[model samples]
Target chain A: MAKSKTHVSHRQYDDEESGWACMNWFEYMLVVVLASLLLLGALTLTLFWALYYAGGFAWTEEPARQFNLHPVLMVAGFITFSGFSLLLYRICRCCRRIYVKLFHTIFHALAIPCIVVGFIAVLDSHNLADPPIANFYSLHSWMGLVTMGLFALQFVVGFFSFLILLCCEGATAAFRASLVPIHASFGITTFMLAVATCLTGLTEKAFFKLSSKYSEMPEEGIIMNALAMVLVALGILLSYAVRREPFRTQVKTFVTERL
Target chain B: MAKSKTHVSHRQYDDEESGWACMNWFEYMLVVVLASLLLLGALTLTLFWALYYAGGFAWTEEPARQFNLHPVLMVAGFITFSGFSLLLYRICRCCRRIYVKLFHTIFHALAIPCIVVGFIAVLDSHNLADPPIANFYSLHSWMGLVTMGLFALQFVVGFFSFLILLCCEGATAAFRASLVPIHASFGITTFMLAVATCLTGLTEKAFFKLSSKYSEMPEEGIIMNALAMVLVALGILLSYAVRREPFRTQVKTFVTERL
Candidate 1:
């Protein structure tokens, strides 16, 4: 909209290109490296943390083992899936708009069950404790629930606005224009809330399980911290991927002319 | 800027006027209300949490008393001051650019000492304990330090780019234009990091002190949770305030034409 017209300088085009522009060798490699690192780091650390400390996953027979699934699923679902969703438009910029939308929606849809199951696993763990621990007591849980609610709300709004309403004759261009930015902003906000929840949850677990040993920086604690950093990096990269263009309409001309 | 040159639809002009346009009565009132709520919530909750739970501020006589200053200063410095700095442009949009810059810089400068003192208070409490607690061990501590470092880096960069270098003939127009977006992004990132740090620290403290009582949701636990919620709300509101417009250039034109 208004951004499409703005021109700070030739440098504005360069600045936009640096992140949002077509692929160059260095920029392409940087994206690949960042995406790979985020994917690999989230996978390896979640598995390591789960298997080594939380005792891996299991079925109904082992409730404690079910508890292990929470962090793993959290990393995979909340961080990894959410991150990939943020990267979807960037990764598939050449794809049809419908294709990108489908992929984005599917990715987030897959994430939902993982998170739901993860929440259930944690709740189950608490319930199965000798003297059943309380559920939703901590700030982590509060924030987690809020993020999930917002995510679901965002999903519904997006689904209606982009998918369903687009097919209907009544959907106005004005509405879509306004909704897109808010949708994107909420997308990042939800991802960040997820990251914050994970960080706090990790810290809580570290202290609860390690007690005095946490102060010593035990292996699990180190792994958890490393995972946290990876999540932070992913968050930053995701922001880079999804942040709105400062100059949109002119940017299109610049990109067209340059290409 | 190219923004001043391009024309979108009349609707875009309207949209730009809605938020990024001039300060309309409703929008102005909304910002004022949000800022007031954020400041009041942060201050009141921090004080309530500290006084009711941590036993308000004190000096050398009791290290625990000294520890009370940490949360107070964190809310005041990291959240409140940082937030106001983000809002400075909007708050003083009618003022000259130099006046806005001066106010922003001074606010941030004031925040630095608050954060520094807060950090020292926590360190002092750890050292002065009966059996000195370890320093910089927890993820909270690590992330908090990292955020502080980023904030400091951001301050120095901003100081040089905006205040010092602006006066020098060598500070090219292109350089200043590029610096603005990055500076704004980092400001928000640093603030989010601070909020995350505060959440984790609060959770850690609640559990450490309350233990099982926390599960039952003691008055202190409730207060801490309230404080945490306020922080989250403040973060959300800050995001609404400072997020970079995707259509900045077009926005300027739309605003100019509409007004």
Candidate 2:
């Protein structure tokens, strides 16, 4: 691929310079928007697949639901995220720095399987009645242990990295400007999941009942899993908002320092 | 505090780098090692807790065991995993690359409650007949859905990352050299969970009878559940083994490339 002057970040894509619109800006934006939607849609289908499986079990009156996290693990898992990482790799060539792309690529790859296997061994065979094969009490035992174990590592990494930005590296001004948007984006994602996980637990017992009464349920809680999801969405939004304010200042500093 | 000529990776240390011997290479290693052991030990406890709950319910004098995944989830999920996540922070300094650490962190955090609340919602209040609300069946139904959902995300992330490495990067030597270790680690983890999830599902109907002396039981299946546990262990061993060959090559590479 020829090196293009176009620059696109996670939040926005630049016009004209991006080659995305060298021919036509409107067409380019539409394509980018559609690509984003396509990515999200692919993800949503996986969720629907599980629901479909459950419905198949309940409605079909057979144990047809004994499917492992199959379709995703072998086929989807192998395809989707790995594919995206490549997309990111392409995006990275135009990135301000190699480190950002490298980090993001590595993260997307590692995070997925930790999640896949962790879910399989701990959560795959579970239900509210049996608890996990290990916990079986409050729905909070071994799965929690494993999940948190991995997350714990993430937190430390984040804290230190954040520290580096604040003190060691970013305090130098050049580093500070380049790092904020992504830093916030990742932070927002983290916060989103954190809040989602918490509220998801809170509402789990209520969801089935809530799902049954969806027609009569309050608009606020229309979906069984709505509340937790909302919080997650909010967290992601706030993360963006919080970080957006600093971008101009950051970029200016970055360019000036470079000059 | 001064910038120095010597540098060390997060996982390595030098004796002269620090003042206190107790604070140096061996001690630091020991601290991290001990901490890891504690984390693992807590995991063991969490697993046993779930087992205890579910087993209690079925093994009870009543028609079924007294406990299930709920107890383990609540006791271990809510409490233990969080506590251990904190411990892991101390051990590894948790910072490596964002990929490994954050992947670890996010998984542990989201997974715990997802398992716990998922279990609680499915298991908390139930009668013990047919579908057996508080038993393993319903638990498996609901918990399976949630666990599978999370794994789907993981698989997509991992599979696509691998694809991206292979594709958008143009199969360049640089891409191959840097990503192969990560790709290998993630692949091994994926395979481990794949086998484990499949076996768990396949053996679901026969778990309780794994080791039973029932003359009528199949020869290779004294009790599928007993065998499930064995498979879990073996699956884990294979998980570790998946890395051995690749890791050895990486070690050689590390020596040749960096060390």
Candidate 3:
């Protein structure tokens, strides 16, 4: 009977008060961290597309044109992600959102291991490898793919869900004011643009493999390159070109007000 | 006895636990937010600098270059700062030290706003000003100077302090291992590079004022423009070349370890 009473009290605490596993603040922060991480991840992937897949990747060739590009983009991308994760911690630091804290702790810890492994794979592929091929593709590629995929899905889906719920019920004023569509659009666009670019990357990597085998850029290689360029160009335009007059104002206003 | 015991207990809590203001996680976040806001406030000064010290001023002449450029760069700069802010936040998210969070928040937040404002001013002045400037000392030019000055100070003073503490702890194995020199070098070089480039901006604005009054390039305008190009070329080299090696290593090591 004593045990039952203690368990009941604890259960009530979990349900009605902040606990380690469930709370509003925790959940909200979890979403923020996830969103930022997703952006960082997308940035990294986009860079990889630019450096390795976009025609400049000679890891083994003396003066490998294939792999020389701006190192800051990738470096800054990770740093940005790390910063966002910190923001998440701060957001929950003030509140007692046990569930978010738990989520934050578990996911970040798990993410650390993944990030470490991915980084090692990248280092090995770049510095240690003899080079024509960095042996970077197998697990390194897929591990990154999965990690990025998880972040992308979590951020987009979470935001979309929150937005829909807000619209359906007319979310509280504080909550309503917080919804930012431009930021969200930037988030989602960065992710989707990354994916579209990645597809082009796969095609380019194959072309590199084929061209290396033949010792020449084949007819198909040239065609694929042009196709890839077009896709990336379109993506860049979409990402940056929205800054013009009337449309920019409408989009910004809607996004700020709605979110 | 009861009153004395209660007084002692309250004192103990004060010592052991952070109060709402000084050292709690929430307060730490508040400091960071406060710093970020300060950085934003600092940007307003940039605008005033241009107005007081710059050369030509005619927003009506270049609507697209004027207002469009302002907000576009503002948005871009903000995005950039936010991205880095997120990374910094992630790094120390779990840190419990009072001084660590306090100083870290202060420096990182303060540094970026200056950079963002300067960047926007420079970019806007060059591209958005519509009609090419006959001088380099306009409202925009002065704003750029302020931004540059604040950025330099923030990087050298606040950044070094933040990094000193960081290196002392040697927390992340990788952070301690190789990031030190690269981190420190960028701290100095970015500033020097900015100084070299920003002067030409002032010259350009000055020419604009003279051009507006006299309707022609001053004798010095031609020389100043040439110097501007040279400075710009050097700045590019500094950014892309000198910064690249450390940045590359940092990027690789960072991505490899932290992801």
Candidate 4:
């Protein structure tokens, strides 16, 4: 039974490879290019909103302005860096699997500092307010905590299971293969959670800062809403990109290699 | 090639059935029970928050109280009913495929009235307010619009393609089969969008209603936050239930029947 299953899979792989040639490269390119733009666009929109409307970044010296860094950096870390990292599998489908894994790790590694600094920026902004506003009280903050925790867990587990286990590739192959779907599913869930957290955060900021002016749809409010829309679009686009089976890596090692 | 592929799938299906018997029913029971509780829990929590804290529901007479119906009914329509409809595939795995489809359709059909009324309640509440609050201006409203639009589209398309096309199943089998994944994917996406929209709406309400008291985490604020958390938990659980391979209907007709 096992031999027959392997033989069938081998045949299916060849068939899928041939089918890939007839597949519309146009659609593939469009998804890749649009995803790339949206990944970068989300960060760009956040930066533009922060600098132009909300006061731009500052450190301990100007805590109110420092609050601006929270959205920008979080978008940079959680949305842009993390999004691009997830997209690497689809975008670099032709690349060697190890190289793709390295790039994935490298991109997520870059996001950690942004997340750390972003976390501190918000904390300082809240703590150093003249009135010293309480932290972690809002729904946004609670969701952010969950998103960050999941991100950290996914990073640690993924790094250990996929990369560290490679030291005993033959012995660990079955164990690692079993982990792939769980990792992939949770990775997408984490991304969705991050997007949800950002949406709530945007809503909180709009109401807090804009107050009555928000209903009138001021320039800054519109910018922030547009930025929110971009993030929503990213959530839809990224989910589709990742879930679409044809876009999936065709090789059998996908079970263990192309996480 | 086609004959070989069908033979392989037949054998695989039998193998999977045996594997299913050996599979831990405990985990399946846990997931089903937890999902059902969370689905009902989400609606119950929303109702508790609405009635106890938000001043309960009304129609056009008391616009402020009428607004409370928005959250409760939305949770019922979007999360509870839609959730159960989605879960029917997993929950009734042993039932006839046509029966499962009918139940799926029936549940979603029930959600439509709730969604329609929930939408109207909010609009009337906004427009009839003493100072006629503006509509569709906030990020929450915008997200809600997109979610509703997608939900409507998914319902119409699913009903037509899956059910209506069955009248000519032999001719439409391939077309209906192609739509299953798309319908399933978008169905989950719409659910996720609804959850995200609810989170944003909850944040908006927390800041608006709780005002200065929100920072202190008052009882009402906590209730709302707790409701938001339930929705978040639902998002994770439902996504896992739908995406998990073992929970999927282990039948050949999944392509054209189980959906």
Candidate 5:
């Protein structure tokens, strides 16, 4: 009876694995394709909103127009670049683990300048205004601060632990393996925080700029709202992609590569 | 050689399990206490904001004051009750699975009235206003609608699959088991959406009611911002607790219970 029970359990495991395998290809492709589209679409919509509705962007020449760079660049940095970086893990499951890690790091590194300039554009816009707007006073600014801080921390920790520690690979293997989940969790949290901050920022902008017109649902209002919805949709899709166990790469290389 | 390799891997597993067991109690207690406090603290702060700052609540008699009920009750329903319900799975790991499920269902059921009344309070406040404010126009309102829709869908699906299908436990066991992760993932997503909705709503309110005073960081603005921080902290802590593998229960009963 005990032998039969063991056999039954082993078969059950096989059945579950096979079930996951069958659905894996289509679902994987769907998530990758949809996520790619939404990431790029969010950036495109923001650019459109900034250019078409909110005058174009400028540096110190026009602070009002300079403020427009804040949203567009933030969406590009936080949503587009950071998002693709996070998705690289699942998207490049067939690639060498080192190649995937390099791409992830590269993508995030590319986001750094965009975020820094985006931060500066807003501050410059506010300070350069005739009657300077108060900086970091609103909830949106506060949330953005938190998100940026988290992003910086994740980048530093990931760089040190995942890449730098690889020099002493044998000794640090277990440590790196343990940090993977922690790094991944915080990465996703940072992304979600960015999404929330953007939404609040958009709300503030709509109310501040559109004023009573926001309630009237002007073209700009609808466009901004659509942009917000895309962010929301991206939040849902990315989280689902990251959390679903069946989508996780099951390659033996994953264990050997320890990433 | 084969037997030795198998023994080595088995011992590694044992070591990992034992390591988790050592840290489990302290970490578990910390998460439970912290989560409980934040969950209640959020609701309390919102009450203070509504009552002290926003002039408290009323029904249709006083439309403006009645709007106060919307934030307070929404926090109670969406953040407090729904939060505790989600945490019960991890918190009551030693309890019978059936009891935990019953409690989860009961807590969510209690939230139903709070949400419904909260929804109506805002609607009445808008419609009964002297100027008759528009409904579902702002990004906040749109986000709220999405949240409420998701909440309702989750309730129906959870009730039907987890509770009603118990009548044929043997035949439906595999089906129910598969639904567990999906249900769990969506539950967390719904909670996060609720948090995002609340943050956007708070931003809208601060801008709409507080107006220019909000930037000066008045007492009410500080209070509302504090409340937002608490919600953000809860989001981080709850997600960590749920996702941490070491914190997950590993009892033999877990498999037998299939929760």
Candidate 6:
């Protein structure tokens, strides 16, 4: 975590170097949008877990309880943490490059454990079921596993390219620059996949658990649908904000003017 | 459809484009990747439909037969067509700007009806059911409606901005240029959502049909999983190819040099 003298702060490229001093309405609104999404996504996911527990949650060799952990951990690791990491560059636009990079790395580092634990929960649920519910049988399981694999791959590549490779003497500026868009594309894609997994997984669970009771869509079903919408909205907003080049280009304009 | 003399061919921008003569291995591979995805995607979807029929398709006011149309039309309209439209800028890199523009516009124009027909199938299935299956109840349904809305909005805005506004004298070159990235972003995002819809929908159907019969891994279940992987792979490849900047930047270099 030691600061290197040669490391230029990303904020140094800001249109103004006064440290978040100049604020625009568009930037403020984007922040508001991201914050609302994170808040709503987390709140709804917690509510879902609460509802599951209220309905009946347990831990002792109970397949249902083990299964319940799947959604909770996934939302925590995959959705929330991943969402934060996606926004880190924008959120920390005023910070030094290394700090932003570290924060982004830390958030993703936290996400992996949660995702692994969630996958384990999924496996445990199937294995523990009385009749042994089949694992990896449905498209949901296939997509979930793929999403996790892509996520882990992204994290490893990103860690090496962005964090480690940058320090190597042989690392050219062009190579570092080239990795940006690829890293970003992978990040956005993986985040969207996580959202997709949540939607599909929830849909599968809803049909299995509530479709019979709420064939006409009782309150619980409605909540699940709403949760999915919030997740989708988050994904859309995150992608839009991430793709905004004007903000980053604005930083370059300042550096040019200063020179 | 009249050709504009002012619009130069995109090929001229190629890193010293004499013609299609400067082909590279990377570009060729990208084309191969895209073609394989499109081929595999269409083939698998047709195979899935065929499997459903082979398993015994019903059309007699039976919700199943009507529901069958949903996947076919969706794959036709949303997945295959939308994906092609997304890649038009890349695939048509050799064409003049206006021609590429028109093709992109026309392809999206064609996708609308297919999507509408697909939605109708969804409605018919729900309505024609004996007790009447509820509509827009599941997370998949919610996401589908939302994706449709976003796609329609993108189409409207793109049609006006790219085609209509460009005809007006007051429209600046900078304005048209700005719309390009936004249009591209929405196009890619919407296409990814369509793929996600296919994945979630297939998961729902497979679980309902095969999970019970082949709870321990049936042949049909494996086919469904394979279909989902193909869809996910297609989404990733499409996004990667679309985000590629070298292909587009090569065009701009020619413009800059001429100016």
Model 2: per-residue Cα lDDT over A1-259, one tens digit each? 2235334442243432355334334533443355344444444544454464334222112223433343334223322343334234223223454354445446555646745663453344443223223232222232233334434454455444533444565455544443443343333233323332333232432333344333234442333234323332333233222222123233334333321
**Which ranges in model 6 have alpha carbons more than 4 Å from their true place?**
A1-25, A31-36, A51-61, A169-172, A250-259, B1-25, B31-36, B51-63, B169-174, B251-259
Candidate number of the best DockQ = 5
Evaluated at residue A187, the lDDT of candidate 4 is: 84
Cand. 2: chain B TM-score: 0.32
> For model 4, what is the alpha-carbon lDDT of residue A29?
81
Per-residue lDDT for A1-259 in model 5, tens only?
Answer: 3445688897887887788777887788898999999999999999998889888889999999999989988999999999999898655677878888889899999999999999999999999999998887788888999899999999999999988999998899888887877787788888888999999999999999999988899988998899888888898899888877566545424744755
Kindly report the fnat of each predicted structure, to 2 decimals.
0.40, 0.00, 0.00, 0.51, 0.47, 0.57
- DockQ list for all candidates: 0.48, 0.03, 0.01, 0.59, 0.63, 0.48
The full ranking of all candidates by lDDT, starting with the best, is: 5, 4, 1, 6, 3, 2
Candidate 4's residue-wise lDDT over B78-183, tens digit each? 9999999988765566787888888999999999999999999999999999999999889999999899999999999989988898888789876787677678
Q: Per-residue alpha-carbon lDDT of model 2 for B43-129, expressed as tens digits?
A: 454356346423533422343333344333433442234334323322333344334334445545554564556355434334543
TM-score leaderboard ranking: 5, 4, 1, 6, 2, 3
* Better TM-score candidate (1, 5): 5
TM-score of chain B of 3: 0.33
Candidate 4, residues A11-82, lDDT tens digits: the string is 887777668666746666887899889989999989998888877879999999999999999999999999
- Cα error, candidate 6, residue B140 (Å): 1.4
Q: Give the TM-score of candidate 1.
A: 0.86
Error of 2 at A132 (Å): 34
Which scores greater on DockQ, model 3 or model 4? Answer: 4
lDDT of each candidate versus the true structure: 0.75, 0.37, 0.39, 0.85, 0.86, 0.71
| Candidate 5: residue B40 lDDT (0-100) | 96
Clashing pairs in 4: none
| lDDT at residue A35 of model 3 (Cα atoms) | 46
Best first by DockQ, ranked = 5, 4, 6, 1, 2, 3
Clash pairs (backbone) in predicted model 6: none
lDDT of 1 by residue, A65-157 (tens): 888888888888888887877676444445656777778889888888998898899888889877778898888899888888988998899
- For model 5, residues B56-125, the per-residue Cα lDDT tens digits are 8899999999999999999999999999998886567778788888899999998999999999999999
Flag regions of model 4 displaced more than 4 Å: A1-23, A249-253, A256-259, B1-23, B249-253, B256-259
Cα shift from native, residue A86, model 3 (Å): 9.4
Better of 1 and 5 by DockQ: 5
lDDT of 6 by residue, B1-259 (tens): 2234334544344434433334444674666576566645675665575555334334546666767767777777777777777676554556766677778778788888988987887798788888887787777888899889989999998888777776673544566666666676677888878877777888788867765775677777777777777777777777776665565455454222211
